[model samples]
Target: MLEIKNLHVELEEEDKKILKGVDLTVEPGKVHAIMGPNGSGKSTLSYVLSGRAGYEVTQGSAVMDGVDLLELEPEERAAAGLFLAFQYPVEIPGVGNMTFLRTAVNAQRKARGQDEMSAAEFLKVIRERAKSLKIDAEMLKRPVNVGFSGGEKKRNEILQMAMLEPRMCILDETDSGLDVDAMKLVADGVNALRDDGRGFLVITHYQRLLDHIKPDVVHIMADGRIVKSGGPELALEVEHNGYSDILSEVA
Candidate 1:
C-alpha cells in the first residue's frame, strides 16, 4: 500500500545527504522490518514519509496507494491513513493525554467527513484498547508522556496507533528503551492492529523486537540504502553476524 521510490533526503542548511536513493514497497497485510546500525537513515525515511519539517525531499517520492505523500502536510498525511510512532515520543507537558488524543482523533475524523465520537464513546474504545495494551487508567489522565517511563511512553504511542487505525503504520524504534515485558506489549499492540488491509514498517536496531512481531519481510539498510532483503530468517542472521557482512556487500 506504500511505495518509496529512489528517495533521497538532505538537510537544507547543510550539504550532507542522509538518504541516498532508497527504495521500498510495503503491501497490505504485511509487516516490513528495517534493521540498520546508527546513521543509516532509517529514521530519516520515516520523517520524510510523514512530511516532518526540516527534511527536504531532494529526490524521489513516497506514494501511498497512488497518492503522492510529499504533497501533503504532516496532519494531512495522518488524515490520509499514515501514522508514525516516533523513536523518541515528545512529552507535551501542558497537554493532558486524553485531551491530546481526543483532539487528534476528532481532527482526523473531521478531515474524513466522519462524525466525531462523543467523549463517552471515545473513552470506551480508548480504555478497551489501553487495557489490551496493559496501560493503566490513571496514566491516561496525565500530560502526554510527561514523567512516563520508557515503557509507558511506548505503550502510549501504540495506543495512539490503535485509536487512529491507519492503513500504513511506520513504527520508528517503538521497541527502543523498553524492557522485555514492555517490548512484548508493544509488539502485541502492533500485531493486534494487523488486518488484511493494513501494513506496517517497523524500524529497529536489533532482531529481538522482530521475534515478537514476526515480520513478513526483513530489510538490511546501510549507508542510506537497502543493502539486503530477505525473510524473517535474515533477521536472525543479522542478530548473529551483525551488519559487517551486509555492509561489505553494499560498499
Candidate 2:
C-alpha cells in the first residue's frame, strides 16, 4: 500500500544528505522489517514518510494507496491513514491521555468527512482497546506520557495505534528501551492490529522484535540505501552475523 521511488533526503539546516536513494514498496497485508546500523537512514525514511519537519525531500516520491504523501501536509497525511510511532513518545503534561486520544480521533474523523464519535461511544471503544493493551483506566486518566515508565510509554503508543487503526503504520525503534516482556507486549499489540488491508514498516536495530512480529520481507539498509532484501531469514542472518557481512558483500 506504500511505494517509494528513488527517495533522497537531506537535513534542511545542514544540507547533509541522509537518504541517498531509497526505493521500497510495502504491499497490503505484508510486514516489512528494515534493519540497519546507526546512521543508515532507517529513521529518516520513517520521518520523511510521515511528513516531519527539518528533513527536505530533494528527490523522489512517496505515495500510499496512490495518494502522493509528499504533497500533503502532516495532518493531511494522518487523515490519509499514515501513522508513525515514535521511538520516544513525548509527554503532554496538561492533556489527559483519554482527552488527547479522543481529540485526535475526532480530528481525523472530521478531516475524513466522517461523523465524530459521541463521548460515550469513544469511551467505550477506547476502554475496550486499552484493556487488550493492558492499559488501565488510571493510566488513561493521567496526562499523556507525563509520568509513564519506558514500557508504559511504549504501550501507550500501541494503544494510540490500535485506536487510530491507520492503514500504513511506520514504527521507528519501538523496541529501543523495552525489556523482553515489554517488547513482547508491544509486538503482540502490533500483531493483533495486522490485517489483510493494512501494511507495516517496522524499523528496528535488532531482530528480536521481528521474532514476534514476523515480517514478510526483511531488508538490510546501509549508508542510506537498502543494500539487500530477503525473507525472515535475512533478519536471522543479521542477528547471527551482524551487518558487517552484508555490508561487505554489498560494498
Candidate 3:
C-alpha cells in the first residue's frame, strides 16, 4: 500500500543530504522491517513518508495507495491514512490524552468527508481499544505523555495507532526504551491490527523486536539507502554477525 522510489531527502536548513535514493514497497497486509545503524537514514525515511517539515525532497516519489504523499501536507497525509509512531513520543502537557485522540479521529474523518463520530460512540470505542492495550482510564484522563513511564508512553502510542486505524503504519523504533514486557504488549497490540487491508513498516535496531513483530521481509539500510533485502533470516544474520560482513559483501 506504500511505495517509495529513489527518495533523496536533505535538510532544508543546509545542503547536507540525509536520504540518498531509497526504494521500498510494502504490499497490502504484509509486514516489512528496516534495520540500520545510527545515521543510516532509517528514521529519516519514516519522517519523509509522513510528510514532516524541515526536510526537502530532492528527488523521487512517495505514494500511498496511489496518493502522492510527498505532495500533501502533513495533516493531509494523516487524513489519507499515514501514521508514524516516534522513538520518543513528545509530551503535550496541557491536552488530555483522550481529547487529543478524539480530535485527531474527528479531523481525519472530516478531511475524508465522513461523518464525525459522536461522543458516546467514540468513548465506547476508545474504552474497548484501551482495555485491549492495557491502558487505564486514568491514563487517558492525564495530559498526553506527560509524566508517563517509558513503557506507558510507548503503549500510549500503540493506543493511538489502534484508534486511528491508519492504512499504512510506519513505526520508527517503537521498541526503543521499552522493557521486555512493555515491548511484548506493544507488539501484541500491533499484531492485533494485522489484516489484509493494511500494511506495516517497522524500523528497529535490535533483533529482539523482530522476534515479536516477525516482519515478512527484512531490509538492511546504509548511507541513506536500502542496500539489501531478504526474508526474516536477514535480521538473524545481522544479529549474529553484525552489519560488517554484509556491508563488506555489498561494498
Candidate 4:
C-alpha cells in the first residue's frame, strides 16, 4: 500500500544528503523491518514520508496507494492514513494526554468528513485502548509525556497509533531504550492491531524486537540506501553476522 522510489533527501540548510535513491514497498497486511546501523537514514525516511520539516526531498516520490505524500502537508498526510511513531515521543506541558488525543482524533475525523466522536464515546474507546497498552487512567490525566519514563513514552506512542488507526504505520527505533518486558508489551500492542488492511514499516537496530513482531520482509540499509532485502532469515543473519558480509557483497 506504500511505495517509496528513489527517495533522495537532504537537510534544508545544508548540502549533506541523508537518503540516496532509497527504494522500498510496504504491501498491505505485511510487516517490513528495516535493520541498519546508525546514520543509514532509516529515521530520515520515516520523517520525510510523514512530512516533517527541516528536510527537503531532492528527488523521487513516496506514494501511499497512489497519493503522493511529498505534496501534502503534515496534517494532510495524517488524513491520508500515514502515521509515524517517534523514537522519542515529545512532551507537551499543561496539555492532558486525553485532551490532546481527543482533539487529534476528532480533528482527523472532521478532516475526513466524519462526525466528531462525543466525549462519552471517546472516553470509553480511549480507556479500552489504553488498558491494552497498560496505560492507567492517572497517566492519561497527566500532561502528555511530561513525567513518563522511556517505556511509558513508547507505550503512549503505541496508544496514539492505536487510537488513530492509520493505514500505514512507520515505527522508528521503537525498541530503543525498552526493556525486555516493555518491548514485549509494546510488541503485543502492535501485534493486536495487525490485519489485512494496514501495513507496518518497523525500523529497529536489532533482531530481538523482530522476535516479538515478526516481519514478512527484512531490509538492510547502508550509506543511505537499501542494500539488501530478504525474508525473516535476513534478520537472523544480521543478528549473527552483523552487516559486514551483506554490506561487502552489496558494495
Candidate 5:
C-alpha cells in the first residue's frame, strides 16, 4: 500500500545527498525487510517518509494507497496510518507512559474525525496490548522510556504499534538493542498485528530479526539505493556472506 518512485533526499544543513533515487513498493499484507550497511540511507528513507525535519526531498514522491505521504506533516502522516518504531527510543522524563499513549491515541482519533476512547476503555485496551508485549502495570505508570532498559524501550515501541494499529508500519532497526528473548517478544507482538490490511517495512542491520518476522520480500540496499530484491533467502545470504558479494555484483 506504499509506493515510492525515484525518491531523492539530502540533508538540509549539509546539502549532502543521502537517498539517491530510491524506488520501492510495499504491498498490503506483506512485510518488506531492508538490510543495508551503515550509510546506505535506509533510515533516511524512513525519516523522510515519516516527515521528520532537517531533510529535503529533492525529487520524486512517496504515497500511501495513493495519498501523497510527502505532503503531510509528521502527525498528519501518523493520523494517515504511518507508524515508525525508532532505532533508539527517546526518554520523556515526566510524561507517564499511559498518559502519553492516551494523548497520542486520542489526538490521532480526533484528527481522523473519530470519537475519543473513554478513559476506562483506553485503560482496558492499553493494558491488554501492554500485556501482550509483556509490559507490566508499573512500567506503564512510569514516565515514557525513562530509566527503561533497552529491551523494555523496544517492547514499549511495539506496544505503541499495537495500540495505534497503523496500516503501514516502519520499524527502523527495531532489533538494534534487543536480546534474544526480548527480540522474540517484540517479533511476536508484530506478527500478532499482521493482517491483509497492513504492511510492514522492517529496516535492520542483521538477519537475526528476520528469522522471527519472516519477510515476504528482502531488499539489499547500498550507496543510497536498493541493489537487490529477493525472498527470505536473501537475508540468509547476507548473514552468511555479508554485503561484500552483493555489493560487488551490483557494482
Candidate 6:
C-alpha cells in the first residue's frame, strides 16, 4: 500500500542530511517494524512521511497507491488515508478531547465529500472506541492530552487512529513510555485494526513492543538507511544481541 524509494531528507537551514536513500515497502494486511538505535533518522522519516513542515525532501519519492505523497500538503496526506501517531503527543490547553477529535473527523469527512456527523452520532462512535482503548469517559471531557500521563497520551493517539481508520498508519514510538499493562492496551488496539485492506509501519526501539505486535517483517535501520531486512526472527536477534552483528553484515 505504501512504497518509499531512495528517500533522502534533511532539515531546513542545516548542513547535515538525516535520511539517505532509504527504501521500504509495506503491503496491506501486514505489519512492518523499523528498529534502529539513536540518531538513525527514524523519526525524521516519520516526519517526512507525514508531511511535517521544515523537513526538506532533498531527493527520492514516497508513493501511496500511485500518488506522490511528498507533493501533497499535510492535510491532503491525512485526507488520503494516512495517519501518524506521534512519539510525543502535544497537549492542547483549551480544547476538549472530544471536541478536538470531532473536528478532525469532520474535517476529513468534509474533504471526502461526506456529511459531518451529528454530535450524537460522533459521541456514540467515540464512546465505543474510547471504551475499547480503556479511556475513561471523564478523560474525554478534558482538554486534549492535558494532565494526561505518558501512557494515557499514547493511548489517546491510538484512539485517534481507530476513529480515523486510515489506510496506512504509522506508529512512532507508540510503546516508548508505556507500562506493561498500558502497552498491552495499545497493542490490543492496534491488533484490532489489522485487516486485509490496511497496513501498519510500527517504529520502535525495543523488541518488547514487537512481542506484542508481531510484525510480518522486521527492518534494521542505521546511519539514515535501512541496513538489514528480515522476518520476525530478526527482531529476536536484535533483542538478544543488539544491532552490532547486523550492522557489520550490512556494512
Off by over 4 Å in 4: none
Native-referenced Cα lDDT, model 1: 0.94
Worst 10 residues of 4 by lDDT: 242-251
Question: What is the per-residue lDDT of model 3 for residues 168-236, given as tens digits with 9 covering 90 to 100?
Answer: 999999999999999999999999999999999999999899999989999999999999999999999
Q: In model 3, which regions exceed 4 Å deviation? A: none
lDDT of each: 0.94, 0.95, 0.95, 0.96, 0.96, 0.94
Residue-wise lDDT of candidate 1 within 1-251, one digit each (tens)? 99999999998778889999999999999999999999999998999999888888889989998899999999999999999999999999889999999999999999999999899999999999999998888899999999999999999999999999999999999888999999998999999999999999999999999999999999999889888899999999899989897787667
Per-residue accuracy of model 4 over 92-148 as CA lDDT, tens digit each:
999999999999999999999999999999999999999999999999999999999
| TM-score of candidate 1 to 2 decimals | 0.98
What's the true lDDT of residue 192 in model 4? 92
Each prediction's TM-score against the native? 0.98, 0.99, 0.99, 0.99, 0.99, 0.99
Worst 10 residues of 6 by lDDT: 242-251
| Residue-level lDDT tens digits of model 5 in 49-99 | 999999999999999988999999999999999999999899999999999
* Cα RMSD, model 1: 0.8
The alpha-carbon root-mean-square deviation between model 6 and the true structure, to one decimal in Å, is 0.7
State the TM-score for model 3: 0.99
TM-score of 4: 0.99
